[model samples]
Target chain A: MTLALYVPRQSAVHRVPAGGKLLALAVLAVVLFAVPTLPVAAAGLLGVLLVGLGAARLPAASLARQARTVRWWLAGLFVFHALFSDLPTAAVTVLRLLALVLAAAVVTATTRVTEMVAVIEWLCAPLRVFGVRPARIGLVIAMALRFIPVLAERADRIREAQAARGGSARGLRGVRTTVTPLLVQLLQMAHTISEALDARGADDEPPARGRRSPVTAA
Target chain B: MKTKDLAYIALFAAIIAVLGTLPAVNIGPVPITAQTLGVMLAGGVLGARRGFLAVLLFLVLVAIGLPLLSSGAGGLAVFAGATAGYLYSWPVAAFVIGWLTERVWSRYTVVWGVLINVLGGMVVIYLIGVPVLAAVANLSLWEAIVSGAWPFLPGDAAKAFIAAAIADQVRRSYPVIERPQRELAGR
Candidate 1:
């Protein structure tokens, strides 16, 4: 199964209110868009990095792993920008993107999925006046979060099986072969999960009643 | 809801987040991201209403500036870009996908489910996304499709099939959640 990506950390970042973190992320994104210089963007990125280090108390090693995953995309963005735009502009764009990404990564690494859902549920409370069901919405968020790792695990198993069967999915062709089976497996898994939900009285629940309350206590 | 159900939702959301973080394959204007897979699965497995809600939750995170999108792209500005159509179409796509799966393909085998899910989800997305993209990017309909929608087709199709197959398997192993009895009877 695709394991949950949340690194278990009892750090300041994790403890910070989800609302605050979300607000900060929004502000940072805006600044990145408004700022137009490489040096400035780079400084912004560095600032974010420093905050991440302090808030998440992320070990240097974990930071490296995160960087490694992003390296290819960063390189690709750099190359694309260099080819299409001026060098300085390209650098700034790339740095801006990186800063945004790293900041997000820090949030994900520290925040638990349940905490996110709680925050979402809280935020959607105002919609109750519009006849929205916060609890139902919360349920949906919860389910999607559950399915990711399950689907990932199934995908991994299928890939391994394909490999065992001598499937040479090493390049573009590999993507095709690998994706086809993965798709097939994903469908099957979804069906299984749906059935499980049905069997578990999923249908018995009444349709969300009266305008959903805006804030459901998590 | 039971704790298990709560757990399932939490798990799927995490999946969506992690998948978003993965490196994207930049085919062109629209980079291939894994959020679509999450979108499809959310609908197919959770049914229309719940699936829509899940996508909304994810989008809320994005709106608040979480870099939950592919390539660490998030924030309100991301919503104003050329790719906004695809991003915004997610909830609608998930609702359509779940509705179709429950209505048309509930009893079908993995292959049939995959086919319907892929076609259904893609059509809805393109229908909404292509037009919005054309308007935003100041491209003609055809040009928007070519630049914004075309590159993602093959990848999305793959995701659809994957979602269908996995959903089908999950149904077979646990037959209880397949569909409402009334719906099944109509089929």
Candidate 2:
């Protein structure tokens, strides 16, 4: 599954550092919610489009697909608001959400996953005082990203195998049969992977010396 | 934590993502997904702390702008959106499930597991999810309860029961959660 939204491109938007892009996204979200007006929402929507399609040089289809994915939600949100509130309010809410969504798409499409992880590490650095290992967290995130496709494939295989075996599994029995085997496979892989990780020094890293580091510096 | 513990957490996080890839029914921003089953499984299989961390890790990845959430929903936008309350409730729900599961580890049964999941995965989620839905979407509490959560009750219950039964099978076959500290003390 090409699950990542990143689209490799060499443009000004892509050139923006991951942290900067993420910060801009945060600000856009705040401004939209803090002042929910039709003009502001419309501007935000247009601005995201210009940056994503014009400056970022991202394929229009890529962003369009994202909008399509949430089309139902968008429609429902709009209808609910219009019925409950008013047309102007509905337009403001919808535009605000659409702009935020597009801006986020631009950010994800422009930045690499590793770069995003680095930003998360920086954000979590403050937690180091509580003995949290940001690197370990990064490793877990990377591992999860790497393995999602693998697990999805395994799930497919399990369904296929069940199909081959007379297709009797249905409802609760079917779900149980599928999930039990899938989880068992994951657990077995975890056993071997842990051994590999230990050999690869995943556990040997020095602990975060939150308490001792200050003393040592003194 | 041991290397194996870290791997379990990461793998469980991956499991959540994989489950999200299953077909979803979208009504509002929050879709009906098998993803919460993975959340229940995490707590049931990894116990409290690790289960919480696994779900948290998956959510952080979503927040990192990966399209890991069901229906390709991810990023700070989703977190800031109306459905953000449900997302916020996930880790806590997983934690509560694991905490309850660990307490009943010795006498665990499919029935017990299902009850735990329903309480944590459904009840707890609705507790936080409805209020946030109301506040963010600017609907009344009754409107939020009627629109945001009511549509989700049956599907969530099915998922809760399925997750519990799956946890029971995993426990009997290839249990991942270690004996809790309390269990060790009692023994």
Top-lDDT candidate index: 2
* Tens-digit lDDT string for candidate 1 (A1-218): 12235777777778887778777887888788767787779988898788778767777666566566667777877887788777887788788987877777676667776777778889889998987666656655656656655665565676678779887565446544565445445445544665676687653555555656667532
lDDT of 2 at B92: 94
lDDT of 1 by residue, B36-141 (tens): 8878877776667666756776776578665568867788877877778877888898888778777754466767667666665788778888888898879999
Interface RMSD of each: 6.3, 3.1
Note the DockQ of each predicted structure: 0.29, 0.51
TM-score of chain B of each: 0.86, 0.95
Q: Give the TM-score of candidate 1.
A: 0.71
The list of candidate 2 runs beyond 4 A from truth reads: A3-15, A24-112, A157-169, A207-218, B28-30, B181-187
DockQ of 2: 0.51
Worst window of 10 by summed lDDT in candidate 1 chain A: A179-188
Report the C-alpha lDDT of model 2 over A1-218, residue by residue, as the tens digit: 43357999889988888999988876777677778889999999999999999999999999897687557766876787798789998899778777876887788789887887788788888998998887777767767776776887777777788779877576887767665876788888987988998898988876555756666878
